[model samples]
Target: MKINPAHLGFDIDGVVADTGGAFIRIACEEYGISSLTLEDITSFDVVDCLDMDQGIIEAIFGRLLDDPLDAGLQPMQDAVSVLHSLAAKAPLTFVTARPHEEPIARWLEHFLQPDTFKSIRLIAMGVHDRKTSYIKNLGLKYFVDDRLQTCRKLAEAGITPLVYNQPWNKNGHDLPTVNNWQDIQALCAE
Candidate 1:
């Protein structure tokens, strides 16, 4: 089966890049505290648990002013191959909550070739819950994201949400989940 979507939406953090570790590390550094493991930061809120100021949070993680790609960020296993396969079939759009676009473009450039990601479009900034609106506006046939809330919102808005399975989202067994990009490729192919 060959399923070609008009547009596909993607989440940036756990979906593409291994940012959880970096976020926690930066948070610890900003607060002048001991290095935090991923487990320590997983259940804790970025603002409260890390004791980080808004400005520092924005500068390090929220805002992508700096070239995060150059910061040695790595793609999730087989992410590049899956994306390349998907792009070969249909348009791929990165729908992230990251406030800055340039850094994302740079980060994507690190993993994907210039031509493969040239058509990739960035959605509105600071629009986390409004992902359904973006999908509706863009006429995306399907969206792949790591957030269960976002996936629910997308489903409520009449879009097929492909939930990217992550350890953080494992508590509930209700949501539809896919293990990795390979599963997404298979889903898209169906």
Candidate 2:
């Protein structure tokens, strides 16, 4: 099969939505972590800074997955707009480590135009490194994600990885990183 060179991919949580702030808010309001902030989430794992129990974090993650498109989790408006524009020209796919597709599909549907995407791809990857295989199989020409590890893997596999800037991935500026959807729009326009 021939891969569509125009096919673009995105990551949920950080890149497409403000998962960091939403996560910290959930942790504080629901899990009783009163003093958490975005700065605390300097790493991919919240437990590293919040010092919260793994189970609690897991429960929160489950909640995020439970109603993945919860309105409280603010969608990145610029990204969605850019997505629609790109979708007008070519297919756009959202590839995520989220275990289920329905919630995200529903969530994305709420924000995007009718034809804004070709698919919402989900992977049962409990780790970042596992996404490389899915990207390869999908034959995505370009992939955007906030995790540096995933970006590295995509680059190693010869797929152009656009590193979405986030607090956790700020240090890895060496990667082909983008500051916002505007940067993505620019890249896709090229």
Question: How many collisions per candidate?
Answer: 0, 0
Write one digit per residue (lDDT tens) for candidate 1, span 74-112: 677888888888787666788887666778777887789
Worst 10 residues of 1 by lDDT: 40-49
Off by over 4 Å in 1: 1-7, 24-44, 47-65
Q: Report lDDT (Cα) of residue 40, candidate 1.
A: 51
Q: Which lDDT tens digits does candidate 2 get at residues 107-150?
A: 77788776554344444455567788887887777788988878
Local distance difference test, each candidate: 0.70, 0.75
Which candidate ranks first by lDDT, i.e. highest? Answer: 2
- Give me the runs in candidate 2 sitting further than 4 Å from their true place: 1-5, 117-127
Each prediction's TM-score versus the true structure: 0.78, 0.85
Pick the TM-score winner: 2
> Could you list the CA RMSD of all candidates, in the order they appear?
3.3, 3.5
Weakest ten-residue segment in model 2 by summed lDDT: 117-126
- Residue 14 of model 2: what lDDT? 94
